[model samples]
Target: MSGTELMEKPAAPAKLGRAIPPAFQGKQFPLLAVIVFLALFPPLIQSDAYDLGLLNNVLIYSLLTLGFYWCFALAGQFTFAVFGMYAVGAYVSVWAARHLGGFWSGLVAAVVVTAAIGALTKLAFARCSEIYFAIATMALGSLIVILFREWTSFTGGYEGVSDIAVPSIFGYQLISGQSKYYLGLGILAVLLLLTVLFFRSPVARDLAFARDKGPVAAVTGLKPVRLQLMGFAVGSGIQGAAGSLYAHGSGFFSVEAFNIDLSLLVLLMLLLGGMVSMYGAIIGAVILVYLPEFLRDASKYAEVIYALAILVIIVAFPRGIAGLRHTLGRLVRRA
Candidate 1:
């Protein structure tokens, strides 16, 4: 146990900046694989425009789930108002498209406005934590849904906004399902990259410390409130962007589409994926999105079947589908 012997390990290399664990970093390979598969999928497998369109929806929902994961897993907040932000982004984008000329402006406006709203929500609930914060955010989401229903002129009230412009840039409209699918996939891929980068950034470290260490983090100079607000902003902005893309791509925007149920669905997606990491978000989204379709022929039992599957996942794999492989490996080693 001499000094030289003890120092031979080299202090674990003093990791200077944030970085994702090697296990999590490996997710990038699968993500890239999925992208390549998607590129070839339409022509080789799907071959149907409707199927491609369905996948585009899945991509949008994946973005929504990923955004929620950023807030819940990274920032350690339980806010569920992302649905509100999503709706606001949808309405804002559509409105902007009608008045401001095109999709780019609408997207820009949606992100900015939704981010501002997220920050404001954080400010208002700065003192609340855990369940209280969850309730307040849920309430805020409820209010947003009501506003969409009541604001006839702006939101189209119960009828919802229709005839949403096709997503375009500089007057070039993406009218085909294949075109829209690629566009949405590209946006999702970019967001996924950004999320990965965020996970490896100093801000992520700060937020992780604030969420897991709380008082210790505060004493160490991390501003928990400010970091939480930033989480909200980032999460809301991502959701908003997803909403905008969904609306413009589908050529429709409805208030009913954004509700407490949608929030719960997002939450369930995260839970199924595992709240411990971002990869869980993707796993949960893909499974939940496709499972329902597979069970469609089950008719009245679809809901029950889906519920049972989720229950099984929750009971058998508490860490989520993302962590399922690791869990199985551990069990195998133990055996």
Candidate 2:
């Protein structure tokens, strides 16, 4: 055949592979399975109130670490103000619950107030470098804690607030550990879904571009400041919600609970779980929370062990547990 005719000839049909089942095609099945498992977990374990409370603690810390992940990993906004936001959320929710309407109104107020504070903080430090911004936030967090301590009328002062009402919905109070656990789990699930959606959206892309190439992004007409502010607001709002849940669940909280140590712990959780992976936050929180319990007998060595573990993780698995999982997955594929 002439070269032109050969060129015009149809190629042989590509080999057809077996069609993959719809259920296994995407993340939907896995996600649903996870949700179902978590929903049924307490019942499956036959956990007592204490165990349920520990699980609730895990969920709370997971939310806090997720907020850290949103601010630092996703938005590239280095911050140490999470505990401050947490404190503000708890106090605001409690105060609003007493004076305004009820638990629900307080929760809303906490989110809104924290979001505004986060946005304003970012706006105020719009021109600062990341390190400076982090320092400013840390300072602001300290200030907030101090404010809560001295402003007794607002936060019950140094004595702290012990009259936090039991969170209720439709006149049904979440007074039991099991009920509270479910509430926290539901909130975490919703936030996790939202986080996934945010990762897949244009806003995430724009934020990434702005974060990694600020000048270039600005040149291209992207407002990096605004995007960063939005990220901060969302992250802070999440922390606030977590704090509000914590206050109602615990029924009491002091300034001591929102100290720098708590902030560092949240950071450690994020780092240990894999800063870039959303699942890492939950993993990290679970491990850290439970590890301390196991080490309580040797309390003196706990801090040392934690330090060593962090060092080893940083040196050996820089990306944390989630990164290790990815590596294992790749190795399995290769094998």
Candidate 3:
């Protein structure tokens, strides 16, 4: 072919050519190691129902991360309402299940109701920008918590609602703390898979696009208001689902459990784990959840330490677990 023709046509490859994306290369060993360690965790710990119960609490927080991951990580929308939604879901489900005579219906109702509440709130705040969104959610959450706390007759005041039922999936009920731990672990696995897969879809891309500025999103022919609404509603729904699980798991529900502190804890989970990376959420969940256990008699102090660690990590290693790994790699090289 002539030079012009050859250049225009494109050159042929050799006899064989192959392409592989190394970014998707296997990290099977690291994953396997993590799984093995977690699987052996109960054995390494006290193994009694009390300690296992505490660990189950950690798993519940992990589930909370899975919910916040949608709003905090994927969509970059921060809401202080997540824990409120979580409480709403838990109590609603328990109450519904007890009254409705089945756990299935309660679970469905919990999510639906929480979503409705979240949708209304998001629509109300759709006009606001980022900091405003957080402030609005915080204010709404505080209001909700107060309602639950002061609406004594219904929510049982500071004492919480007790004797609530634990859930049974396909007739296999969680009879003990260890059993509940395994069940929570299973549900968590399902949620992780769904979030990771969902992250690659157009829906996720649309949400991310809309997060920058509402006007920009409007100009792009995207409904920023509606997108934020959907994310807020869905994220709240997930929190509710986690709440449902927690209510049954703990056999109780209280305003204190799902108050603003829990909201900050969720945020910490996002930051410590690196909100952009799914692994970051999981890492943050594990650290924050277990740190209290290691604290023993002075767990409140451990929380202070955890907060300090989070600030340091955010300032020094914004990339999360992946970032820390990169830093360690450089240090190893220098050494």
Candidate 4:
């Protein structure tokens, strides 16, 4: 080939670039693959208990991530009482299951209690903007943790309540990691599907409307008040259910399980992931949970690493991982 022609051809493709995804490209296949891989990973690492535990931790964090997204991404909520609601679920589940006879009853009790707490929080702080709401909720979170630690009879103090029963389906025991993984995955799948359907509904759109009261009130035909309350109640119930499932899966409950650290992590996960995508919540949860394992004992510096990762993603890839793929696809098409 002629040197001039070859040089021009090479640069031409670079200038043309790759095609990008459309504004509404569906992401079912790729996301489904990710979910399947995660489900299978633990069994492949069969000999390592730590890896299994890490996987489980990611699954739990995914639930937290989804709850955060439901409040923040879908509803435009800046509430900080996630862990508080979660704690209520754990403690209430423990008490209810022990006193109320069955697992179903305990789960129902946890959801009812946590939903009430979450609704009350929204009623009190729904008017507050970001900073004040966060601070207030942060303070409330510490109080919940402290109260749980101090109330020995109810929360079992710092030692925590242990030996919780694993969840059963149709009178069958689910004691293994594999069993638990599928259970957690089933819950996550249901929630994600519901979230997707809700996003398509007018109710979900109303909640995430621009914060300018006049604009939102004027433009949107949907009932903002009812929608916002529904988002809070439903999101909070997921967190409650997640906590109940977690307590049983992990077989314990403690102050540390629902502390301020957990709160911060959940917030970061929501931020780090594409807040708009439920799958992004799951990805962020998995990465945050398993990053420590990849680092081994050096994970003591995980807080630092995690912070840097968040900054890099926010600064360099503003759309987040899930959104980045779509963004790149669009850019390619635009080019």
- The model with the greatest lDDT is 2
- State in Å the error of residue 166, model 3: 2.3
Scanning candidate 4 in windows of ten residues, the lowest lDDT window is 1-10
Q: lDDT tens string, model 4, 167-245?
A: 7889988888777777777777777666655544444334555332525664656555556666677778878887887
lDDT of each: 0.76, 0.80, 0.71, 0.69
Q: Once superposed on the true structure, which residue ranges of model 2 sit more than 4 Å away at CA?
A: 1-29, 32-36, 43-46, 297-301, 328-335
Model 1 misplaced regions, further than 4 Å: 1-44
Worst 10-residue lDDT window, candidate 2 = 1-10
Cα-based TM-score, every candidate: 0.87, 0.87, 0.80, 0.81
- Candidate 3's C-alpha runs over 4 A off are 1-46, 213-216, 295-308, 326-335
lDDT per residue as tens, model 2, 1-335: 11011122334434485544221223633663575476657634856877887888999999888888778876789899998999999999998998887898888998899989989998998889999999999999999999889898777776789988888878999888888888888888888877766654457667877877889999999998888789888888889998999999998788888988888989889888887567778889988988878788889999898778778887777778767855666778999
**Over 4 Å off, model 4:** 1-47, 210-215, 218-222, 297-307, 329-335
For model 3, what is the error of residue 175's alpha carbon versus the real structure, in angstroms, after optimal superposition? 1.7
Best by TM-score: 1
Candidate 4 or 2, higher lDDT = 2
Rank ordering of all candidates by TM-score, starting from the highest: 1, 2, 4, 3
Tens digit of lDDT per residue, candidate 1, span 134-166?
Answer: 999999988988888899899887787787878
The TM-score between candidate 4 and the true structure equals 0.81
Evaluation by TM-score, superior candidate among 2 and 4: 2
